[model samples]
Target: EEVYASQPDGFVDPDNPNHVYKLKKALYRLKQALRVWYDMLSSFLLSQDFSKGLQISQNPRGIFINQLKYALESLKKYGFESCDPVDTPMVEKSKLDEDKEGKTIDPSHYHGMIGTLLYLTASRP
Candidate 1:
């Protein structure tokens, strides 16, 4: 991954005043570097028998990695605890319809909902 930085004061070459420096080494703040760090840490955690309880994907083979309390807490934290329950997760009849005339939702709120759902999947084994 490419990383860029501008030369600090007194370090800039006077002949190339408009030039910016390209980073050759992976910095701790870079996104790719952070991902590598996270992978290493997660690998270490898994090696120690710690599961990623908040992960979204489910594993088969009848493993009982329940996160019921975590799911409940997440729902409450996202203000869904008192909301009316749905018999089914989605309505098949509305699958093809686009909400062209419906009120617009905040993008941040929509992302928050997705995040909560992903976390809620931890309870599913």
Candidate 2:
């Protein structure tokens, strides 16, 4: 996985003006950079003799591995573990209504909830 970047504004090489510099480290905020980080982490874990869990479903017909325990732990960490369960995880779009004058929710909290849902749904078919 090679990544390249153009030379900085004042640091361009006169001799090779068109040559882009190869990245020696991961750049911040790029999605592919996360893969590099995960690879590094998995390598370190393997070196330390830590076994990775498959987290597969108990059902024989399941295709994807489910990280149920981790998801439950995350929900508990966010104080939502014991909250009332619902047939649907979110509200129906058709039943939605705008509240222009209502108080705004915290951005961080909203992001956390969305992140949790993403993790939970990733393992589903």
Candidate 3:
């Protein structure tokens, strides 16, 4: 079905007030646009040679997507439950500097943390 909508109240063009915007991209909650969107996304996933099971759900509010469970599991696996929550990914900004006088961090510990971050970014990005 063809869909056209007038510009929003404040966004309407002064010179062409009668013109309406024609939708090219699927907009969720706009008729069957959600179905069209899923078709495009699933086809792209298939083209990447990936299997099924993309987690997504619909509710009264809207679509929901998150990796909080996976993130929590990863933190627990890496023994980060005791670590202070930092704004940065690996560590706080001040602690990032190299300390010549301090004991060097274990290479294996660094490797595991970095590897975990890489794997998470690969899937989540």
Candidate 4:
């Protein structure tokens, strides 16, 4: 619904894409939107001379910081390269928590997963 409330297809007001169209807001429901949005926002910030994170040379709308080489490397490092990729980060409004009664896992492994995800986020939060 949100994604539909925007300009028509392939719409980009070259005159002032950011201020007039806000192409960023319309990407929510898109495939690989997380990546696209990230790329656009980062580029926008850089264009505006706003500094916060690493600056990498990129293609237009090269969104999605999660696509970093390190992220892929981490996936291969952790043997998750073949894992099914999901469009959404998590199910909508889903609750996640530790299962106290479930079989215990090694804390180190848990920490490792956390570490890997943190790297993947690339300051996502």
For candidate 2, lDDT tens digit of each residue in 20-98?
9888889878777898899999999989965453475556675566566666777786888898876987767867779
Q: List the residue pairs that clash in candidate 2.
A: none
TM-scores for all candidates: the values are 0.36, 0.41, 0.38, 0.34
lDDT of 3 by residue, 89-117 (tens): 66445556577899977899889888878
**Top candidate when judged by TM-score against the true structure:** 2
TM-score of 2: 0.41
Indicate whether candidate 1 or candidate 3 has the larger TM-score: 3
lDDT of each: 0.75, 0.78, 0.77, 0.66
Candidate 1 lDDT, tens digit per residue, 22-116? Answer: 98766786778888788899999989966566534446854345666666766786788888876877766775768899998789988987886
lDDT per residue for candidate 4 within 10-44, as digits (tens), equals: 78666655544334354566675887788889899
Candidate 4, run of 10 with poorest lDDT: 18-27
lDDT of 4 at 55: 34
RMSD of 1: 14.6
RMSD of 2: 13.6
Model with the higher lDDT, candidate 3 or 4: 3
Name the better of 2 and 3 by TM-score.
2
